[model samples]
Target: MPELDSSSMTNPGSKRSNNEDCFLSLPAQDLWMVADGMGGHDAGEVASAIVRDTLAKYPDLPLSESIQRAHQAILDAAANGIGAEGMGSTIVALKHHGENFEIAWVGDSRAYQFTPELGLQALTTDHSYVQMLLESGAINSIDAESHPDKNIITQCLGSQEMETVRVDSLTRPWQPEQWLLLCSDGLTDELSHAEISAILQRYRTPDQATRELVKAALNAGGRDNITVQVIAAPSQPKPSMRAALAHWVPIFTHSRRLDAIIYTLALLVLFALLYWTIF
Candidate 1:
């Protein structure tokens, strides 16, 4: 199996006094996360910290389950009166397993995938009122991005209703040599998809890409807390003849052709057995 290369950066942005965002990067575990804390005062920071700590605590768990644990922790903290008034946080996480990836998130924080062939595509949907309106045809995408309610997220951790708490998720085969980007809404609010795609295309390494992304977002206004994470799958390696055979042999064996042949043989045997009994 191949390994993943990852890099991350976080900033308070131009207007904020302190950064309330938190991130987790565990390349060995092939897990990465970003959380944007909400609520005034330091409560936001506390919520974000709890999200990060809880999400990273169990590397062995699935990404969805990890987020569930994180959400519960925030709920617990809120009950204890630890700067938890109206406190909640948005989270986006990606876990690489074998040749597939697991993605889970809440609120407006998002994940994106970029490849030279496909350009840039969003992997997760924003859980905000604007998103809801856009989906309902109440507002166009251009209007939604700049809407007043764009920042008002519909779901996140620390909410009183735990039963309704759920993380949106997606799983797909990992595209090798592709770039995976995750960030808080601060970066997206400031930069457009084309701008982010350009920066990702220009930079070769995850560190360079993530740095330039945050820098560009700050230069564009930086109204909120910003955090960026980038992960790249290892480049494809040339396979030897033996390795190639090992990879494709199983696929061929279980393909539609083999199934058709087996079905045909079974039908023929049944026909012959019936003919012998009748004779």
Candidate 2:
């Protein structure tokens, strides 16, 4: 199995006193997520946290199901949860399933894939009005960046029941030396694609990239809560001996239990056969 190296951070940013964004980086489970929140009375954080906490239960699950569960969680919380009725959050998650990378999202949070060969490519699209207009050829990238309604998202996890929950997803083969960047609108709102790509090209490790990228975004203008998760797989991932042992410890324990059960069953069968033959 390939090993994942990743780093994550969430900052209140230069503007917000409270950070409503939440992120998860679990290399062992091959799961990464970033959720940007919105609401009044600081309820936004609760909504985003609910999504993150809910998804934590099943890290190995596909993004579609996880997001769906998150949506329901938010709704359930709203029945009695303070400030949860209108609380909403946008999510973008990347799951490493076997050899494929599954990228999923709702609202405007994004996941980006970068490699020397491909440079940088956005793996998930925003579910915002500006994005819709951009896709319809009604606006160009330059115009969409400054569009008046740029922040108006069409889908998100919230209290309201959506007629249909649609989670956008993509599956790409996991390749060596490939890096994935998961973040909320905070980073993209300030840093352009070229700017982000420049930072990624500069850093060799996910941990370094994670810090520098957040710093650069803050310098540019951290207007919203900034959350980032950087994940990279080396050309040939080799975990440290200690790390390898830690990962295998649980498997070894389970194997031992299974072996004992099998041995017991075999002994029982053999004894019964012998008794029948003698009698």
Candidate 3:
């Protein structure tokens, strides 16, 4: 059996009176999400709150459904902007199923997986202009962080005429002691991978680790709002015999229509077996 736990923390930094970071963790489905808001005006905070609150409405939804709900919520919020101005936010969310985790993201918020042996591996791409510079080889990955346009996101919720958020899923052989880190750009922009690894190494729990890490950013000169959520679960726990007997499926990668098909079929089979066995 694997020991499972997670902890998280957020800070407003020294610059902004209004912190625009929003975070949520649903252990029942092993789901976690974090959003970082932009702040030229109050719109950023408004957009961030809308996304978080909308996602919370589906606390028990399947991963795919929850993500779609969040995406649409952002679209709706964008339509409700103040005057001629626009508002938006960046998001990263994770959902854990039996032996794997599904990830979804938009903008520059990031997701990383850390292991005692493998160090830290980034799972999401920054939807920023610096990313384009790196892709074109105009600058190296090292320079992207300090690039003047590093903060300029190529895509974000509510920015375009027709906005679409990208959802990506990855399945890995789960193991005990593995940790998933989800955070806003604030943490990454101000700190290096080595520095973050050092902080995680020093702290034993998610709470302690996240708190200390945010503190480091503020001390270093917090230029933006910061947020983070951690999701940790044992890699290999023996499946309950009953659960094993009932073959289950996850619909994260499925299209909305197909997801309906798969879940419907699965439910029919489950009820059929129940009627036969019980009677």
Candidate 4:
């Protein structure tokens, strides 16, 4: 199994005094997640926290099953008056089994894949009103970006109207050096896909990429709680012994002693070739 390097960051943004977004990165368990909460007061924070805690507590469960449980957990919390009524959250979760990976999500929080070849590709489609409009050709991409109802989600966890949350999922082979990005809409709302792709291309490591992305979002006007998780497949293995030797050959040749030895070997090879031709 290829090793995975993961990093995560969450910020309250410039306009928000409190952050209602939460994330989890468990490389050991091959799990990662991001949750964006919604509600009045601190209920959003409570809802997001429940999502994080519930998913963390049930690492052994399947990704879809675990997310369903998280939904039920939030509903239970609201029923018991643990949080304000109507508090809910959007979520995106990822898990890997060797080279194969799965991503499950709800609401508008998103999952994306990045590679040198593909640049940035969205893995999960948004469950937002704007998305519905785009699918129905009622609006174009540019119109959706500034749509008044862009933030209105069609489904999410802990909805009083929903008995069971509808979870969307996808499975794919995770290639080496590819990056998996899970983030709340706060990041997307502030940064365009092209802008995000540029940042990821600029930063080579997950930690650097996550930090820069958050900074860019803030610079672009952070309107909501921003959360991001970047997971990268293991880098290519070290070069072979022959390649390593070739890499050092020029440096070694700069030494007079090694230069003399190399010259001697070349002469000996030439002489052996001549001798073999004569024989």
In candidate 4, position 112 carries an lDDT of 93
lDDT of 1 by residue, 133-182 (tens): 99999999889878988898888888876644678999988786798999
Instruction: Give the candidate number with the greatest TM-score.
Output: 4
What ranges in model 4 sit over 4 Å off? 1-3, 238-279
RMSD of candidate 2 to true structure, Å: 13.6
- For candidate 3, list the clashing residue pairs, or say none: 175-235, 176-235
True-structure lDDT of candidate 2: 0.85
Positional deviation of residue 11's Cα in model 1 after best superposition, in angstroms: 0.5
List per-prediction Cα lDDT, in the order shown.
0.87, 0.85, 0.75, 0.91
Candidate 1 Cα deviation (angstroms), residue 97: 0.5
Cα lDDT tens digits for candidate 4, 43-146? 99899889999999998898889899999999999989998889999999999877689999999999999998779999999998899999999999999989
Ranking of models by lDDT = 4, 1, 2, 3
Clashes of each: 0, 0, 2, 0
Model 3 lDDT tens row, 126-167: 888889889999999889867888889887765656445565
Cα lDDT of candidate 4 equals 0.91
Clash pairs (backbone) in predicted model 4: none
- The local distance difference test score of model 3 is 0.75
Ranking, TM-score, top scorer first: 4, 1, 2, 3
Residue 224 of model 4, lDDT score: 85
Question: Candidate 1: minimum summed lDDT over ten consecutive residues — where?
Answer: 244-253
Using Cα atoms with residue i matched to residue i, what is each candidate's TM-score against the true structure?
Answer: 0.84, 0.82, 0.77, 0.86
